[model samples]
Structure formats: structure tokens, C-alpha cells
Target chain A: MIPALGLIVGIALGIFLDPSVPVWLQPYLPIAVIAALDAVFGGIRAVLDGIFNDKVFVISFLSNVVVAALIVFLGDQLGVGSQLSTGVVVVLGIRIFSNVASIRRHLFHA
Target chain B: MSSTTPPPPPTDPTRQESGWSRLLEAAKPRANRKTAVATALALALGFAVATQVQATGKQGLESLRTTDLVRILDDQTSRNERLDLETRRLQATRDELVNGSSKDEAAVKAATERLNQLRILAGTVKATGPGITMTITGQPGQVTYPTLLDLVQELRDAGAEAIQIGTARVVAQSYIAEHDGALYVDNTKLTLPYTIKAVGDGDTLQAAMNFPGGIVETIRQQGAEATVTKAPSVLVDALQQPPTDRYARPVPSASPSAP
Candidate 1:
């Protein structure tokens, strides 16, 4: 979970400071890689003891990218790109909170 | 229990043969280790390839970021351009009002009255064509600059090719606005009941004046009287010399040039 969180945060920081980087890959890559790493490091712990559900990881990965892109495209069509970006940030903020909560629960064994 | 049941033959020859085979095969466990090592190498290679793909993916992300930045900049630039145009227009208007005549209050009132009396004299219906008349009325409260600009914008939008407020014709650089609680139309104080005249399509022009939620309605709501009429022709002289500051040079009189 710590490594997964780190990957996501790293990617986010990189994209924000250098906007030329493609944001579309942001949601899936970090989470997928982290989850894979977790599976390697802690084996059965992921299935029986880790805080994250594999399904949630996959769903968030799919939804975040698609929803964010769709919203930006829609905003462009409506002539309100800035407004759409603000919305994306809000959604991502919520996702970050949930992810942190999961991490905390897993690490604390709660 | 096995001793009692094992009398059931050798359970085929396999059990006896496997015991002999295992004793013979103990030295060849090296092959099994080699296979295990090969599998580990394959897994390691797969992991390396996955990491390489992630690096390529990061490059793609960088490209998208640049694109968003350009788009953001372009949007801001367009907004800036629009504001700049509006600022220049307002500046020109301010210059016209500051440098133009200040006696517009009396002239516009007189013109309004003249128009009203003329309307009464000419009756509601007349064969008007080329000439135009404008009416200005303000609310009891202080006149605002936005209101003044609104009137001017409406007139321009209405397609009035030629327009005059008080004694000054509307020009490319002219502006209308309010300052110090007074309404100003082109550098001149314009009290209530201002009259403006223009030359162009009378009916189309009149329709333009009373456009939805326009100055005409605003004026009427404020209890200010306004009227527009097209005349056969109304002649107007060129604008008077604009007022100048003490800092500027005095104008020479219209006289014959010295040889």
C-alpha cells in the first residue's frame, strides 16, 4: 500500500509540474504496478489481510482515466475547459482520501 | 494393518520398480534444479520488460501535459485579446468626452424640446426619411458610465451610419459616459431629455433602438422621455473645435496666409 501510494503521488507530481506528460496513463499505471508489487512482497497477505480489494484497484484504475478524460472532452465541447479540470481535481481528491484510508487500515491492521 | 493387507501381490510391479528407480535417480536431482533456475530467469525477464513499458508510458504522459499547457495558454490569450479591444474602445471614448464641448446639457435639452414641439407641430405621422432625432433621459439617481455606453452601443448596433449628439457628430473616436454624477455624451454635459440625430433606415433603425432590454426601455422605466424620428433631411455642421487644455497651443484664426 505504501509503495502504491508513493507511485500515484509521484506520477501526480510529475504530471502537474510538467503538463506535457500524458495524463491518460496516470490512473492505471501506478496503481497496477503497486498492486503487483504488493502481491509479490506479501503473497497471501493481499488476499486475506491487505486493506485494498483487487476489484477496487481495477475499477478505480479504469474509472479515473476514462471519467477524467470524458469530462475534459465534454467541457471542451461546452466551452468550459477550466471548469472541467476543477471537477476532475475534486474527484481525484476524493479518491485520494479513500486510498489513504485503505492504506491506513491495512498498515494498522485495523 | 499394511502387513496384513500387503499380501495382495506387489500392487502391480510399479511400487517395487519405483523404489529401485528413486535409488538410481538420486544423482540426477541436478536436472530438476536446472529447470527451476530456468523458470526463475523467465520470470525475472518478464518483470524487466514490464518496468521498461512503464517508462515508455511516462513519456506519453509528458506529451499530454504539454498539450494541456498550450491549450490553457491559448484560452487566456484569447480572453486577453478581447479585453484589450474593449479597453482601447473605452479609452477612446474617455478621450472624446474629456476633449469635447461641455455645453451639451443645454443643447441636448433644447434639441429634445425642439423635437417634441416639432413632433406636435408635425403630428405623430410624417413622411420622415433621412434625418434622425435621439432622446436622452436619465433616472433621478446619478447617471452611470455603463448606461451611457449602453446607449452608445445600442445606437451603433442599430446601424446608424451618421449620428450627432447635441452639436457634435458621433465620430470613430467618440465616447459617451458619466462622471461626477452627471451624464456626459461626447465631452458635453447632457441633462435629461437629450436628443440625438442620425441618417439611415428609419424603421429598421427605430427597431434597433427598442431592442429587447435596451436603453429605450431603461429610459422609459426611469421616467425619462425619448423619441426617435426620421426626417426628410436634417442638416448639421461639422463638429466645433474641440476644447483644449492650457498646456496645448492656441489655434490660429481662419485668415489668409501671409505670402
Candidate 2:
């Protein structure tokens, strides 16, 4: 419940602040968002299974974003940035679907 | 990265040997920090998501570098100016082609006789016909611009087709303006003893000039000796280039008319 409230407050702050993304970080924003989403979904699935760990969740979230951005940055240096970004998104998307499916099974029992 | 540390070996007796199964196993809840940490991460995720959406939304290109934006604007402005210049040049070329072809068609219809008449009017060729030559010897300022203008008008009225004063070929746009006691005939300065040569009916022109209270009589009243002499073949040899108009453009008219 508190996490949900924090999400709404964060959205409100973003809308009012109207923050502009820095040019240097613009290419990584979408990748980071997907990585964070994957972390959140995985954390929720862990919670449903009664195996949620605070330290593990926070560490995964941080590493997910940082690693995603790093991969894209390295790919840019190697002139394969777009392909790497696409690979990252696809992997994260599959993980999200799997975690969501687990959550659905826990909730609906189907 | 928080994953900077490697995972420990599975050594607990209660834990299973398989790695995937450990993710679903139940564990004891210890810290209140879990909810707080999740909430903060959720907030960060929400803010990033919102900002990413805004970037992709209507405010596109706002996130680009200033130099990139200026270069784009500069490229567009210069391209627009180039296109405008091209449009003007194309329009002028079109007008020239259309007008030039139509004029050529009309000129093709002008017979040899009409062509000769045009040549005479343009003063591009010599005119030889049954006409008269009149000589006027006037005082210093007696033959003013008005007197010369009246003489030319009278000759035109008497059906004098081509006329010449002194060495100047009088065309349709001819002018006589007085400048400091001398007469300027279309920018050419002429002093006394003006010889007017005209190509037309010699008898009629002589009769008109020698009429009672006419041009010759009027010139005599202005203290000038004017003589009218008829000739069978009078040659007006003064040649002048055709006048070029700068401001005036030919009015476009419909061509290919019905018979």
C-alpha cells in the first residue's frame, strides 16, 4: 500500500517538475525503465511466494538498471548499440511476462 | 552495481540443492526496511517512467543538444531561401517563353509592307518617298521646344508618316525639351538652322506648310526664316536605335483567337 502511494507521489512530482532529460542520458532512459519494471515485477512475484528479501530486491533493482545502461553504452562504443538495446528489452520483456504469469497464478489459482 | 558481489554457495541444510527452486521457498520476514526500500524504488521507477513518456510525447526534440537544434534550423532556413529563389527564376523564365513565342507568331503575320512601315517608325532604316524638306533658320532662342513640338505635331496631323529634325530621327516616343536657349530633341542638342525631312505626299505636305496662318506663318511671326520645298524622292537617312523601355512591360493578351 505504501509503495503504491509512493508511485503516485513520484508521478505527481514528475508532472509538476517537467524535468528535461540530459542529452548524455537520453539513450539509456527507456532501457533503464524496462530494467526497473523487470525488477519490480520480480519483487512482486517473490512477495507472493513468501520469499521476498529486502536487500536482494534493492540490489537487483539497482543492478538491473546499471547493467542495462552499461550494456547499451558498451554497445555504442562497438557500433552495435541498437542491437544490444533491442536484445536487452526483449530479455526483460520475457522476464516480465514470466513474473506476471506467476503473480496471476498466485492470485487466481488457475 | 549492487550485483558487484557474487552469490554465496548454498550451504544451509534446510535449503534445496536446486537453484531455481530456492526462489519460490518461504522465508522469515525480518526488517521494516523492506517496505520502505520498495516504496523508494517504486517512486524512482515511476518518476523515470513519467519523464520518459514526456520525452517521447509532444515535447520531441527538446531533449536534443542546442547545437544540433541550431544546425537543423539553419539548414531548413537556407533550403527555404534557395527554394524561393528557384521559384522566382522559374516564373521569370516561364513568362519570357510564353511572351516570346506569342510575339513571334504575331510578327510572322506582319507582311513585308507592314515590316517596312515598322522599320520606318523604329528609325532603324532609311525612308525615301515623295515628301518635302523644310529648313528653318531661327535666332538664338527663337526656336524653343514649344515651337519645334508644334511643328512636329502639325506634320503628324498632315499625314507625315516618318519625320526627321536636323540629324535626329523622330520616332513615336520623340520629345523636344528646351535647355538653356538650345533645343533638346530626345536628349540630342540642336542649335538654329533646323532641317525637317518628312516622307509622305509631297504636294499635300507643301500645301499644308504654305497655308494661310499656318506653321510657316507662325514661324515667320517668331522671327525665323522657314522654307518648304517639295521633292519627288526625298531621303531621310538618319538612323537611330530602337528605344528600350525599363519599367514598362508588355501587357499579356490572349492568343490563338477564333477566326
Candidate 3:
């Protein structure tokens, strides 16, 4: 419950800070940085359950970095990079939401 | 050959949850999936409420000047800033459309017809295969109207068949004005270091302005502003107008004279 609540609260605050800020600055927000902290929490959960995989963690990290940079670059070229950066954050947002949802389900499953 | 999937990882407490169970026991009613989902949803709802409340509150406090109402005042000011930016962008688009479209179709058609007659009068539809260049610079402080007008007149007297100021075409009838301290050429705001180009005879145009107290001399006295030069290949485009209706009749004249 705490993790899920944290994820939602963080995203809400992120959106509220500059709901209309040029999309480019979206991924750079402290909120997104904090949201990425979820994978750490997930790693913790996995280690506790003896199911940690270094490969999965590494791949996820690499993909996030690549996608974020690519969005910014493409946006800069097309004159919509700021908006596209916001889109990259949205992708991160979905991941955070789903991870929280799954953790919730895992914890509460009778 | 059929391939068998690898078995799921072992859930041995010895390797995994050594201290997690103790932590879980200390924190009773640790949220299950459903409870966690509910909590997340609640948090989302709370944030939405707070955001809306702040927005409406800011709008309400715009007229108030209470010393303690700093937050309210700042929000209102930022909102206004965003609105002003949007207005400027829209205004630019509107000007682009207006300047692009046909202004006086009938007059343009008449002008074109008159040009054809003049071509017959001059015995040729073409002006010349060579021209001169007129480099117009702003005054030391800023580029203003009188200077711009003088430059335009000089180009005209120099027998310039084509003239372009900055990026805008110098049509037969174009209006240039300054609004809110920004200089606009043909209703389009120009950036600094304005350049005006003219296509005409180099020698004839040069000789025409060779007299003392000419445009170049006047501009030079004004300090670091406006220059005119001759070019080998100055291309002037004959401006075209949108087609007018062929069978349209003129409006009946209102006879206001003493009858």
C-alpha cells in the first residue's frame, strides 16, 4: 500500500508542478527520478523472495536510458522534443503504475 | 524437437526472506494488492482535488491585494504570462494569413492591365538585364520609420524595378508600422540588422544619387546607419495579384455634389 501510494502521489505532484511545461522537461523531473527508484524497491522485493535477476534489472535500466535520450533527440529535430520528453515520462509512469499494481496484488493475495 | 521451459526459481527462505518476515510481522496489515491499489487511487484523487483547488483559488484572488496573499498573486501572474505567450503566437499566424491573401483584387487587376499598357508605352515588357543593390542599415540606436521611408524613396528614384525590405516584398502599396515598440515591415515584426535589396541599373542609379546631401550622405550623418551599393545581378520579381472577376461592375457613384 505504501509503495503504491508513493507512486501515485509522486506522479500527481510531478504533473501538478508544471502540467503544461514544455514536454521536453518532463523526463528530467525529480518526480521521474523518484519514480525510477521503484525498480530499486522491486529489486529489494525480488531479493527478499529469492527471485532477483541481474539481467532483467540491467536491461530495464539500459532501455530506459536509451528511450529517454532518443525521445529528446527526435523531439529536438522535429521541434517537438519537449513534448516528446513528456511522452517518455508517460511511459515511465505506466511502468510505475503497473509495478505498484502487481506489488499490491502480490502482497494482498490470500 | 520440443523444448521444455526452465523451472521457476526456488522460494527458499534460507536464501530470500531471512529478515523480511520479521519486518512484515512488525508492520501488521501490510497492504495487500487490493489495499495498495485502493491507496494509490486515493492518493491520485487527493492530488487532483488539490490541483483544482489551487487553480480556482488563484483565479478568485486575482482582484485581492491582501499582504498575506502572496501565493494567490503569483499564481494569477504566471497564468497571465502563459496566456500572453499564446496570444503573441496566434497574432503572428493571423498576420501571416492577412499579408498572404489578396487585399484589393479589382485594383490589382487594374494595375496589371495598366502595366501591360505601360509595357506597350515603353515598347518592352522587360526593364533590364542588370541592376543595383541598396544596403539599408538601422540608425546607431534603432531603425525607425523616417529612415525607412527615405531608403525606400532613394530606391525608387534610383529606378529600382524590384525592392525587398528585410524578408518582405516591397509591393506597390504596403503598410509598415511600429506597434508596442516593435518595428514591423509590412505588418511583420523584423529582427535587428534589417537588410533592404533593390534591383535596378547600377551606373544610372549611382549617378542619380551622386549629388550632395543625397540619401547615402543623409544616412551617414545619422551615424552607422543605411548604405547603398551597385550590384551586377539584381533579380526583381514582378508581384502578382489574385485574379479578379471579369464581369464585375463598379459601384454606382453617390452624387453628393450640389444638384
Best by DockQ: 2
The TM-score leader among the candidates is 2
Q: Which digits, one per residue and each the tens of the lDDT, describe model 1 over residues B161-230?
A: 5666665555565777667777666677766656677666677677777777776777676667667776
Candidate 3 per-residue lDDT over residues B1-259, each given as its tens digit? 0011121454564533244453354234465653454345345434534443444354443322233266576888999999999999999999887776655565578789988755523324323346665565554345566766766777677776666666666655555777665566666666656666666777877765545887667666666455556778765443433235689887777865312
DockQ metric, candidate 1: 0.02
**In Å, what is the interface RMSD of model 3?**
12.5
Q: Give lDDT tens digits, candidate 3, residues A33-87.
A: 4333444444434433445455554444344445556666666567665567677
lDDT of each: 0.51, 0.81, 0.54
In candidate 2, residue B243 scores what lDDT?
A: 78
Query: Per-residue CA lDDT of candidate 1, range A1-99, in tens?
Result: 333333445445444443332355443343333333332222212222222233443334344445555666666567665566666666555545544
Span of 10 residues, lowest total lDDT, candidate 2 chain B: B1-10
In order of DockQ, best first, we have: 2, 3, 1
TM-scores of the models, in the order given? 0.29, 0.50, 0.30
Query: Against the true two-chain complex, what DockQ does each candidate achieve?
Result: 0.02, 0.38, 0.04
Q: lDDT by residue for model 2 over A1-110, one digit each (tens)? A: 67767788888877788898888888798899999998888877766655567798898999899999999888877867778989999999988888788766656655
